[model samples]
Target: MTRRASATISTQPSVTDAPLRYRLIHDQLKNAIALGKIAPGLVLLEGPVARVFGTSRVPVRKAFEMLHAGGLLHTFEGRGYVVASPDGSAPPPLRAPLSESALGFDEAHAPLALPSNSERIYHAMEAAVSIGITFGHFRIDESEAAEAFGVSRGTVREALSRLRDLGLVEKSAYSHWLCGPLTARAVAHDYELRVLLEPAALRASMPHLSKEKLTLALAEVERAIDEPDSIDADALERIETALHVECLSQAPNKKLLGMIGHAHMPLTVNHAFYNAFNLHPEAGTLVEHRAVLKHLLAGSTEAAVTALADHLHAGQKRTLQRLKVLAVLPEPDLPVFMHRIS
Candidate 1:
């Protein structure tokens, strides 16, 4: 039996100026413990709490650490935390099935609003910029993008800021946003960093990778391989994400995860190439994916990590070739914001 969270607290941001996400989670769990909605000896795990909040486990783990520091939660000889007994005495762990309403978000307080305007438009902007860069040097008009997306310039600016963080776009000396002419050197540079960083991230993530999750990821790869004709650029991207982003998402080091994300500029190139050519990922690409996923499912963490690095190594050549092809082809129709500069 597994104990579950049972809480009643507002998800709304507090009056304080601090970031709301982690603070909200902390407050919710603290209130639950104080109210005895969560029993004194019940176990609370990061995974379940994260699922309830529809967020990543990192913040949930942070909240748990905060609770332990505050003496609201204490460590037992187990994986998760135990709620502190009110009388300053240790109690046996309480394990039982939780009620339907237990650990549920209150309907009135549910945080179900759509993401901010910037987030909503970010992927589309990223895709457009990624594809645009393959053609030649270009300038992005902030005002034009605002009009095209029916958003404010400020919103567009924020989205572009994120793009800059990922090294997708940069400001020229004249202060215009420019995306390029992705060079082979840049592709190789990204892979060089990935081969070092991604394998380490995968090793850190192995402890958290559940068998079921790996199985589903492997199944997706196999499906793409079997039905290559049915696999489009979008499907190819999905399989790539299953291994790269989603699989590695559970790593606890925030800075490491951010670095891994920043190093993925090459992913956009691969995606844009497949879409441009109306092609699927190469068979070798799918086979490499299958190999890594299979090793993970077999509990060979080192082998899986090594396989991932090998895949990246192979992918660099493929991506570089695609870039060469795109460089030679006539520029396709671009979005309103983009203007070819060279």
Candidate 2:
């Protein structure tokens, strides 16, 4: 008979109290391993762990790497990690069901409250609503959304409420949540705000911009442009985010940054357009992004600002064209959670 590892729960600090989210997840998993709660030879996959934690796979991936490094986990013949035996020997892989309870995550003892289900579903819903709005106004079915995401109704409500805060959705007078018919006027309004604000934010952020970050940003653009056919909506969005979001993240003013974030509805618009049409970004966009990144790399703050503003101006036109195409095209089938109101 194999000897079981002694179960020892850490008494130091709550996992949630960790500053970095990945670190928190790592610590929790490590503790679980130490306690033998994670059975030896159990296969731990990223997607399941992310869903269990109500987080994206990125953090779970990082946590898995940390565990593997610590010898608590080992790479097997297939994907994901297999728990190592207490004697550091390989055991038969166990593809058993993993749960919070099995991992010693419970309310009474460690109290490792997973992130709210709302957070887990927010991005998917955001993408749906953002893309749906371009074609026509929509009324979101809260119950259906909850069912679709396999979460509670209250969770969907919280996610929609956050969208409302971001100006992505609105509550009707009759207490219904509405998304949009994203009009050219609304698109222009968002671009106008971005044109005025983002350049200023860029200028403010210039001194704080690191060379390595700029180089990486430049590399991403180059790669996307070099491999246009392979580029997907997510990659395209990352390039846009590198310039508009990540690059401007170092600006000194919090209020200004907050306002800029709210004004970035256009980014979503572009993202929706590309995804809806199954298209890649135009060469022009890649070039414009490259120009601004180059200017920043060369330490030309003013040039970078000018290039960024110009790019936004040009992007507004391209975005308007995308809206026009959506206007002409047949309306796509709405998701179960969405119903056309107009």
| Candidate 1 vs. true structure, TM-score | 0.65
Off by over 4 Å in 2: 1-116
139-222 per-residue lDDT for model 2 (tens digits): 998988877777799989999998886778999998899999889999899889999999999999999988998999899899
Clash pairs of candidate 2?
none
Q: Against the true structure, what is each candidate's TM-score?
A: 0.65, 0.68
lDDT of 2: 0.81
The sequence of per-residue lDDT tens digits that candidate 1 reaches over residues 199-247 is 9889999989888988988888888778787788788888889988888
Q: Per-residue lDDT for 140 in model 2? A: 91
Q: CA lDDT, every prediction? A: 0.78, 0.81
